[model samples]
Target chain A: MEKRTEPALSPLLLAMRGIVKTFGRSTAVDGIDLDVPERAFLTLLGPSGCGKTTVLRMIAGFETPDAGDMRLDNTPLADVPPERRPVNTVFQSYALFPHLTVNDNVAFSLKLRGGVVDIAARVRRALDAVHMADFGDRYPHQLSGGQQQRVAVARSIIAEPRLLLLDEPLSALDRKMRGHLQIELKALQRRLGIAFVYVTHDQEEAFALSDIVVVMNKGRIAQKADPQTIYSRPADSFVADFIGNSTLVEGRIRERHGDRATIATALGDVTAPAADGLAAGDAAMLVIRPELLSTRGEGVATFTGSVGNSVFQGERSMIEAEVAGVSLRFAAEAPLAAGTPVALWLDADRSFITRIAA
Target chain B: MTFRQRHLALPVAAAIVAGCLAPLAVLVAFSFYEVEDFELVPAFSFRAWGELAFSSTDWFLIGKAVLSGVATTVFTAILGYPVALALTRLAASGKGLAVIVLLTPLYTGEIVRIYAWRIVLGGEGLVNTLLQGVGLIDEPLKFLLFSPFTIALVLTYNNLPFMVLAIWVSAEMVDRRLIEAARDLGARPIDAFFRVIFPLTTPGLAAGSLTVFALSAGEMLTPSLLGGTSGSTAMALVDNLFGTAFDWPLASALALALLATLFLVASAMAGLLLRLKGARAVVGRV
Candidate 1:
């Protein structure tokens, strides 16, 4: 686990161009394009069966596309076999060989490549990087789920693969362990400086770990942007709703200005930060986050409604207010009881127009 | 005791075991006492044990039985593994039919199957006719029946289904995801099969081999039907001691000796299986 002295500024480590993969008659990964910047933590975020894992497998050479091309450093990946490719996968199951010790599992790729020089040393170094150096002598079953996952990560990263793909590597662990390891894995990726393409259905995990989040829906890229942009200004309704809990109220663009638009919804007219390509009269949804709405009336737009339900999360209380026959949810620090009448006010300057239907 | 209370069941089961071993215990007791006109005296003697131990005929017969058993078991395992693999890999719709087809020979009586093989290996059998039809031989082959080769073939055939069934069970228990994982980890098909599938199935292989060996060692009807005096096994020797010579003590001693030999073989194989289990643990670590 030699630390790269300087950031490796190589070109895009991998690319998927109009890739299509189908299982039975169902298209798992429809025509889509993806790019992994060198040394970047790119997470393919989607719900289950949305084909994020399929995309990672295609890049890893485990699954081939039926219609399009994949390139690793501008070279076609179609002809390369998995063993020959400079990519490795950390499977969702942590696919560690059940018959080999942790040291042996970590050393497997090195042994496969005929690296007989100080194999134990190499394994130790890799294990140490994941804080698992002492556990190398133990069997996989003897280790906890998180330990197995760390070993799986160590095993893959030991090869020093140019493109490391993780397919829901933490999905098997309990919530607390997954949370801890997500931070550690992000740190490890940064330290190793290898381009990572991670796939997960958990959007929170993806957003917390990735430098660039590619939000996918129904085998298509809803948006590919940095975590901040993906969270703050999701490109579409799917991206907004998938990335986080968002309230999409149907609306029509009433007016527009540079970087902002006024939308007239059934609830009322509200000013929303306009993304590029939005137009007047376009049917859209004002994507307001629950946290963005507040109890204090201090924004450009507001609505009055009766609170239907209120859930008190530790730091914030989420209140679902029935506005204009639609259940509009907003969050505030203060507790509000159900059936309580309140004004759902938004800091319209922060809200974005996420979706405008064709 | 109430009608619902069934403590009688345990006593009955214990009585059955004691009854079965009572004659064996008596035979063992008699083995240590000197014989006078087929009656055991109160005097303790080591003559029977010494004679049984030092007799070159006894040693040779034991050696022959062990060698034959080993050969037959090896033959069965070699032929059965492929069949087992094929059986376990069948589609769900076809698996039941395959099991039925393979178990048919097993359910058929052993003597009946031996008689069937006897006909097939006979001078005027279908095999000889087929060989003659091919013009590879001018006359029927006599060596096909009543030889050590025929004995081994019949024993292996008889034990084939058991070996195949054991291996099929192991194959069925193998985690399919491990194979896919190996492939995903960059192992080619052959490497995955040999490194993962083969080692994981070692327990079944050991079980199957031990079963085939023990059963072939004591096989009576198959050898008698297919092999005569030339390849007379230990069971036949034990039979002669009991029937022709009317030597019950010697027959019991021979039977005990055969049992001891099978026990030693089974222990050795069990040890091998344990080592394989340890290896499976190491595999898990990887």
Candidate 2:
């Protein structure tokens, strides 16, 4: 029951603390604490069933937290219903009111509140932002899938909510349309300066649109960081593997120095940057990106492998090889043909080592 | 052989449908013929039609009955919606049990249910005993039974299941996510129900209203039992034509007019409900 006019007092926009949602006997979102700073573009990124969408639902007040306190600014939102919350959601299904015109769909919130002033102007502006101004008269069935998605966005943004929760908004569109809308939505978010809490399993879309990417696994956060940090320096084995292409080699910590450590694996012994809580005899994964492994090198920490195949991707070539009967994948500029002898160079600086939890 | 099978099947199906309509068509045709010794004559005249059109008393009585039927239909809808809502809100297992209970009265003969109501609403019935025990009244209230109100109450109870079922079916078809979406759009729980839930279920409500209207219009059992002499319905008038007066032509005329009016009202109700349902689907698709 806080004052609605005091928007400045609660500038965080949305703060979800220790959110836990359980369906039947199983937990869908476990002990999640998330915050979206005012006007920040935050993406909840994960594979399917990782509870990213559940987190978005909790923020939008669609799902109640079993044990958590959500706040809009400094005000506790636990008791506030979804409709009363200053948050709007773009559902995965688009969920545009089928009976109303596109203009009516966008103006729905305004109509719900029984206010008539300037609805047309606001709806037009919202449609223009999404580059769908002329679609105001069209019914949803008449429009294409991409147009429906844009109309869904327009409907949400027309109300000017403090936080806009997008649940895989672009996933239903074609790839090219998805890419185009991603740029437009990003630009629109920046222009409006409204907080956008986007949820998606697509890593590329998350990386493209998010100021901060929250990677989730089994209803818990794997890592939360900027796109570059999450890509380059993932917190654990799961984060590293889930984010990008990496050669995860199982090994044991052989030695640890002040800032450097070396692990012994089936591939070879390689020195890597020191990770916290690393001890001798502890099982760890040496996460090395494909491009970090070179095709030809003779070094102290190098593996001699026969390249089985090379995939000629436009930017880089992916070489799959066997080193000591262990399959290792690496990327290089030059394509190596099948059954070719190759020496793979391992770079310690680019490789992140983390203790694997059993 | 296939053509022969089609020919046989189609004719037989058409005969079955025609068999259903033959009784009403015979009544319409009989309205133009004069009755002699309980047998209809082959010759036709405009005399019965003229009598039906000019008889102001019959028109007044039929109009009153129609007005009462409409009122009872509305009453049934109002009473049925809450029960349907409560039923829909129940757990799946509970819903199954509830549906069984709601349909129990429908399975038993209408005579049995009317008698059961008579026991409940009678002079020395459950209601009288309860009122006497509570000392709310010194005597059993005669107003409770044998009145238009009694007939309306009976008609509503008789038609309650159809209304409830119609509303429940529509209510269940509503996408739950839409309610959540409305809430996410800053609608209060009450607002969400009014804007999303109720509007979406309107087709069901309209359907229920139409069902109750049709059932109440053709109701004979309840009016004959509970409506007494003063609160007679259109069906009671038709029954009297065939019974006490033996006025076959007048009864046929009244039956035809009643059937036509019921058809028009039912069609109008269905058309309006369909338009609303279509509008809901259109809005929901996006």
Candidate 3:
């Protein structure tokens, strides 16, 4: 029922109010409101089947909302077809037309306009933007997945739409390729100054590319904030759990003062910055980020526990320590053996205490 | 030795050579042999060739066969595209039902279908009767049956299934996202069809054209029975020469000529369709 939107800083490019979409009996998008500022990089981030993509589809005019009002540049988008809308999408699959060469694929919209005198020059520039100008003659099948993805971006951007929608554009690429394209896409968004609404389940991708991140769950937005705020001060347990390698300990608030609360958990009572409106005896969760826990600290140890599991990652190891029947996960530079006695210190001042999501 | 797929094709290839090429070789020999008094002979001569080469009537009939095949192919393709694309849009279960519905007419014997068509298109048949009842016509339309129209209509109806099925299979293989991408890139529905859907399905169209062309070109019974004055086909003449007339040499020459012309036309049709960028993009990669 609450509309969660930041005050418009730049000119608003797109605004959706109370948008809802359903397929047969199951609802894909619950009533939700969203806003995109001009030249903003906004990301709809969630797990699969979280209605992020449905929202993107609604914006691209691929899926009509069942009950909602959507406007772009102060014009209602209800009657505009996808082709007529000044919007384009970079599909998740990169859906490059197989029959056309890369040059023709990028020139598709211009050709449809009939007698665009500078189509070839514009196509060259679009392809050059994606570093794919040399592949003008290549067919879609002739190119690799990443190359196809680049061509897809070139095609969508060639028309210079007012808004661009991307549905997990980098998901199909290898990890290294995904990282490369993420940097490229963010740079492209900045250079073009076109508003971008990107949908992805990868938290790191969302954080890396977006100025505003919308976390969705069960066809509704769980949280909408800047990525740093979302990471350090998650609105609820769901946002905290979904974002990073964090341990959520079930607890109840014992006292609240100003912006801090002391929550009683199985381990012990700890004071931390908490979400607003948390009174005593209210159910809450202590979000222990991996960075907040250390084996060596200046103060006295918070808990004495034994290392339960340590997975050796390339640069660091993810270590889980068992204390009071709770598996507390944290990262360590070196792998620790199981059953090794470890004394862990909790930086409760920086940890977040937030309400449990319904 | 390890067996491969090409090796498996050996026996089928042998059977075809034995069943098809050997008979063609025999026809080549028979075309040169002179027939005397309806008696068996093996003497080679140019008499049959000379007669066929000079007969304008035979040439006209052969030209008519080519035109008929091309017309039927074009008609079926024009009508089949929408049905095939519609079939692709159906749900999986609905598609199964649609396929059965499309092919249900084919389940009836061709002769039965021809008679059913006669009942629908004849002077006193369903269409004419309905038209008369509606006062659209003063007399039954004579062109309804026992005309070239009847033959073409019947041929298109009979061959529509094959064309639709071929295109439906191809259309089903096309990723739906491409069409969405086209629309997102500012292509209208009609533009998407011409620029994306139509080009991508050319391989299917080529296949369907070849099949319909072959089926309608060499057909004899349909034209002979349903095509009254316009019913004289090269096939019928060949049949007459081989059976009632007993001019085996001339019959062999005419049949071989018809086969050559049809083969050339089919090849050209296939070549033109397959040469499209869309077809090459699909088939070349595969």
Per-candidate interface C-alpha RMSD? 3.6, 3.1, 1.5
Superposed Cα RMSD, model 1: 5.1
What iRMS does model 3 reach? Answer: 1.5
Q: Could you give candidate 3's per-residue lDDT for residues A52-162 as a string of tens digits?
A: 999999999999999999999888999999999999999999999998999999999999999799999999999999999999998888899999999999999998999
Best by DockQ: 3
Weakest 10 consecutive residues, lDDT, candidate 3 chain A? A1-10
lDDT of 2 by residue, B1-286 (tens): 6877888789779989999799978887878888778777866877788888998877777776677668877887788878887887799999999889998989999889888888999889899989999999898988778887788788888888998998898878777777777777667778777767777787788778887887787777787887777566678788898788877888889878877777787787667766763435633453
DockQ of each: 0.30, 0.47, 0.74
Residue-wise C-alpha lDDT for candidate 3, range B81-200, written one tens digit per residue? 999999998999999899899999989987887778778888889999999999999899999899999889888988999999999889988999999999999999999999999999
Better of 2 and 3 by TM-score: 3
For all candidates in order, the CA lDDT equals 0.81, 0.82, 0.93
lDDT per residue (tens digit) for residues A1-358 in model 1: 4333433664666777899999989999999998788999999998898888888878777678999988777778898877778788898888777777888778877776674798888899999999999998887888999999999999888878898889899988889999899999989998999989999888889889988999888888888988999999989877877767788887888888888888888877888797787788988888888878776765544778888988888887777888789787787786687888888667788889857532
Candidate 1 at residue A356, lDDT?
A: 54
Instruction: Sort the predicted structures by TM-score, highest score first.
Output: 3, 2, 1
Weakest ten-residue segment in model 3 chain B by summed lDDT: B34-43
Runs with alpha carbons beyond 4 Å of true place in candidate 2: A1-11, A297-301, A308-317, A332-338, B1-17, B85-94, B277-286
lDDT at residue A292 of model 2 (Cα atoms): 80
Report the lDDT tens digits of candidate 2 across residue range A1-358: 5664535733666777888999998899989888778888999998899899888888877678899888887788888777778889999989876666789888888888875688889899989988889999888778999999999998898778888889999888889999999999999899999999999988899999999899998899888889998887777888878877787888999998866688998877888875688888888888888878876666543778788878898888887888887777888787877888887777778778875732
Q: What C-alpha lDDT, on a 0 to 100 scale, does residue B171 get in candidate 1?
A: 76
**What C-alpha lDDT, on a 0 to 100 scale, does residue B126 get in candidate 3?**
98
